[model samples]
Target: MTIKLLAIGKTDHTDLQSLIDDYQKRLGFYVKFEFEIIPDLKKTKNLSEDQQKQKEGELILGKLNSTDVMIVLDENGKQLDSVNFSQYLQKHMNSGIKQLVFVIGGPYGFSPEVYQKANGKLSLSKMTFSHQMIRLFMIEQLYRGFTILKNEPYHHR
Candidate 1:
């Protein structure tokens, strides 16, 4: 199965992008991983929070194929540790799905429509994180999860 990460906006910080790239390369050894950035909405200062979410939701939903299983990275979603997350990845692989898409929404978070289309929701932490930082965190976790699954020395546990 292919694991895809879709997030809103590009990472402006070079340091963060470099780290994300490194993990992405490491992940390629274990699985086909794709990181896609959805461009930020224009004239956001003119739109209301709900309006922005609605527009962003459209862009997010447009990226998916009919068979893709979308899981949104939501603040109120389920949180799992590295080991459990590895098992979660294993479960999805065993289920024989084509693509597993995890989305990171814009500033106001996902819209009702986006939430409704999601197969599941996952949270990296109870505390909030910047969208750019979340990209790195998510990618690094994916790499860590694969290492755990392979019994690699990368993960201490």
Candidate 2:
């Protein structure tokens, strides 16, 4: 199964992008991984929060395939520890899905339509994080999960 991460906006911080790139490369050794950035909306200062989310949601939804299982990274979603998250990844792989897509929405979060289309929601933490930072965290967790599955020394258990 291919794991794809779709997030809004580009990472402006070189340090964060470098870390994200490293993890993405590490994850490639275990499974096919794709990280896609949806460009931020233009003239956001003129649009309402709902409108921005609606527009961003359209861009997010457009990137999916019909067979993709999408999961949104939402603040109020289910939170799992490292081991449990590895199990989660294993479960999906066993299910024989084509692509597992996880999305990190814009500042206003996901639109109602986007939420409705999602197969599930997952939260990295109860505390909020910047959208850019979440990209690195998610990628690293994916790498860590794969290491755990492989019984590697990367994850300390």
For this target, which candidate reaches the highest lDDT against the unseen true structure? 1
Clashes in predicted model 1: 0
Which parts of model 2 have CA positions greater than 4 angstroms off? Answer: none
Summarize candidate 2's per-residue lDDT along 102-144 as a digit string, tens digits.
Answer: 9999999999999999999999999989999999999999999
Query: What do the candidate models score in CA lDDT, each in turn?
Result: 0.97, 0.96
lDDT tens per residue, model 1, 1-157: 9999999999999999999999999999999999999999999999999999999999999999999999999999999999999999999999999999999999999999999999999999999999999999999999999999999999995
How do all models score by TM-score?
Answer: 0.98, 0.98
The local distance difference test score of model 1 is: 0.97
Relative to the unseen true structure, what is the C-alpha lDDT of residue 58 in candidate 2, on a scale of 0 to 100?
A: 98
